[model samples]
Target: MEIVLLEDVKALGKKGQIVKVNDGYARNFILPKKLGVEATSKNLNDLKLQKANAAKVAAEQLAAAKELAEQIEKVSVTLKMKAGEGGKAFGSISSKEIAAAAADQLKLDIDKKKLVLPEPIKTFGNHEVPVKLHKDVIAKLTVKVTEA
Candidate 1:
């Protein structure tokens, strides 16, 4: 029997996949458990429409991310931190702080999780930070850390 999987089966195939299984297995386990449905013409058409819609939405998101990346690249964020002797910073700046600064200074609402800092900002100077806006989009932001 040919079946369209509604959900993943560990040994067989993932959701949205078409797989051929024995008649007894499809009737007893797959159909009864609602893990898959018979590969009817209507069901196949519905899957095709769903996949097209998903692809369209994904493309829109990628375009939006690219636009945001352009804006982000032009803006610079300034962060103030407490410093001790010899111009050393007391504590390092975090992604949350950077996101807050970007929001407050540039009016950009960036998520802290998207800011990728290899190491915390411990020095009082200018630095470039990479912000991942999307899977394929990365924006480089200039951050200036000054003594408060």
Candidate 2:
């Protein structure tokens, strides 16, 4: 029997996929659990429409991410840190601090988790930070750390 999966099944296939299984298994486990439905004409048409809608939504999100990436690339955030002897900072600047500083100075709602920092900022100088706006888009943000 051919079935259209509503959700992913590790043993079978992914969601919105059509797979063939034993008739008894389809009637007993899959149908009773509502994990899949019989692949009729109506169900197949509904799946096509759903896939189209999902593609449209994904494209929209990608476009928005690209636009935000352009805006983020043009802006820079300045941070102040307490300096110790011989041009050294007292503490390191974290992604949380960068997010807060961007919010306060540039009015940008940047997620701290998206900021890819190999290491915390510990020096008092100009640094380039990569902001992962989307899976395909990455923006470089200039961070100028000055001694306070």
Candidate 3:
């Protein structure tokens, strides 16, 4: 008997997969546990429709991410910090501060966790920060640090 998996079954198959199992196993385990349903013509058609819908949604998300990346690349956030003796910075700029600055200055909603900062910025100049907007989209944001 052919079965359409509603959820993953270890050692058998993953969700949305069609697998053949013995009649007794299908009736006793797969059906009773609600892990899968008998794969009829109607069920197969439904699966096809579901796959098409998922593909459409994923494409839309990718397009939106691309658009956001473009917007992010054009933005520059300016932050102020106190200057210490011997040309050293009194305080360092963190990812949280950068994100807040962007939100306040440019009205951009960037996640601090997504900002790739190897360490707190301590220099007083222009810096390019890489922001991971999506799985495939990485945008560079210009940040200008000035002495207060």
For residues 102-132, what per-residue lDDT tens digits would candidate 1 score against the true structure? 9999999999999999789998889999999
Q: TM-score of every model? A: 0.93, 0.97, 0.88
Candidate 1's C-alpha runs over 4 A off are none
Stretches of candidate 3 exceeding 4 Å from the true structure = none
lDDT of 3 at 92: 95
- Residue 88 displacement (Å), model 2: 1.3
lDDT, candidate 2, 60-141, per-residue tens: 9899999998988898999999989887799999999999999999999999999999899999889999999889888898
| Lowest summed lDDT window (length 10), candidate 1 | 80-89
Among all candidates shown, the one with the greatest TM-score: 2
User: What ranking emerges by TM-score with the best candidate at the front?
Assistant: 2, 1, 3
TM-score of 1: 0.93
CA lDDT of every candidate = 0.94, 0.94, 0.94
Question: What is the lDDT, from 0 to 100, of the residue 106 in candidate 1?
Answer: 95
lDDT of 3 by residue, 36-113 (tens): 999999999998999999989989988988998899888799999899898778989999999999999999899999
Deviation of model 3 at 21, angstroms: 2.6
